[model samples]
Target: MPYLNAAAVKAQDSPGIISVGVLLLFILIALQILNVLRKILMWWIRLLWWVTVGAVLVLFASIIYQRGPEKTVEDALRGARHLSEVWWREYRRWEGYQNLQQQHHVGTSQKSWTSRW
Candidate 1:
């Protein structure tokens, strides 16, 4: 009978099998990309979550541990002013020392000393 032709049946089914295999390969690639994206998103979320937690902990602890708002602000202001003054003094000293070195030509490069002479 016409339906009993096994070779014809096998040939007809081969194309369908090939198409299914190709579709499966495409699905596998899509799944791999999806997994990679999920991992990256999870890592980023974890980093942000920890950073936020640390910041909140620091802020809350400072507020609870400090004596009062006025003390905190005053201390901060005082520290800032002291730091500014120290930096300014240090800068002036550094500039003055540099000027002295320039005048005396102490510890200068050979080329610069020769040029100066």
Candidate 2:
């Protein structure tokens, strides 16, 4: 009338069942710990990358600040304007000198030709 024999059920070991349950619990705990460690490692890598990018940006800005000609925009513009005016004056002087030289040469050549004739 019963599906299981009472004597056989009583003979089955209980300690083996408990040991299997404990083993599976430990395996699950280990998997959870590994997952947490993987997430932590990914977070650490991202933090390091951002820090490196910040350092590079700071270095570039410092170099530009140190090497720039003028500290202020107004000073830079004024200096550039002064330099352009000086260059323009020098160019006009050079052009006038060139014209005088050409005129002197033409006059000298005309006199030489008339004397030879």
Candidate 3:
């Protein structure tokens, strides 16, 4: 077997090393994008949650103002339960729409990369 000198070894390994480096860079970039997108979505979710709670509190305050505190507690409790059920159902419906859109899109290649592995 022939020995690989330093220059010969470097030449032999350069393409593979470069390819790996490029692949790593690509993956790192993809991860960064995903992280940013995740943060943005989380921000939106938080904002929506706060807004929903704030709106409910305002509505409750209005109800208390209009009807007084005596009979409002039971009504508020029932409304809260119904509101939670409706909120989750609507959220799931919206999520299903997004999933449907994702599933129906046509693709040339590697479209299901996340699921492929």
Candidate 4:
């Protein structure tokens, strides 16, 4: 299957090993290129992550500065904590809804099976 030209593979005068050597070289070069591309992707991804985190920090700092004198670092932390709590509650609500939907489906399927019998 590797030799597309059947006559060339079977020929007595042609150098068949040269084709295999070239294929091997091509695969090696392709692997090296892929490795370099992967490294470049990783570098860019890391740089992007740093930039995002830095931007968030700057925004958070600015918000804190804009708040009245009554607001402190603890207030910011508390807000973050409250946000996490709200997200947790929302996740639980979604999970419960999914469970209810699955149960309803199962119940209907069971009813259909009983009716068929």
Which one is best on TM-score?
3
Return whichever of 2 and 4 wins on lDDT: 4
lDDT of 4 by residue, 29-114 (tens): 99999999999999999999999999999887787778853686778679999999999999999999999887997877556455
What lDDT does the true structure give each of the candidates? Answer: 0.85, 0.81, 0.86, 0.84
Q: Which candidate comes out best when scored by lDDT?
A: 3
Predicted structure 1, TM vs. truth: 0.45
lDDT of 3 by residue, 57-105 (tens): 9988998999989779878789899999999999999999988777676
Off by over 4 Å in 3: 1-13, 74-117
What TM-score do all the candidates reach, one by one? Answer: 0.45, 0.41, 0.54, 0.53
- The TM-score obtained by model 2 is 0.41
Task: Give the lowest summed-lDDT range of ten residues in model 3.
Answer: 104-113
Predicted candidate 1, C-alpha RMSD: 9.0
Q: Give the better candidate number (1 or 3) by TM-score.
A: 3
Model 1 lDDT tens row, 43-79: 9999999999999999967875775777777877899
lDDT measured at residue 17 in model 4 versus the true structure, 0 to 100: 71
lDDT of 2 by residue, 31-74 (tens): 99999999999999999999999999987678668866355556
Q: What's the distance in Å from true for residue 72, model 1?
A: 12
Question: Considering only N, C-alpha and C atoms within 3 Å, which residue pairs clash in candidate 2?
Answer: none
CA displacement after TM-score superposition, residue 73 of candidate 2 (Å) = 20
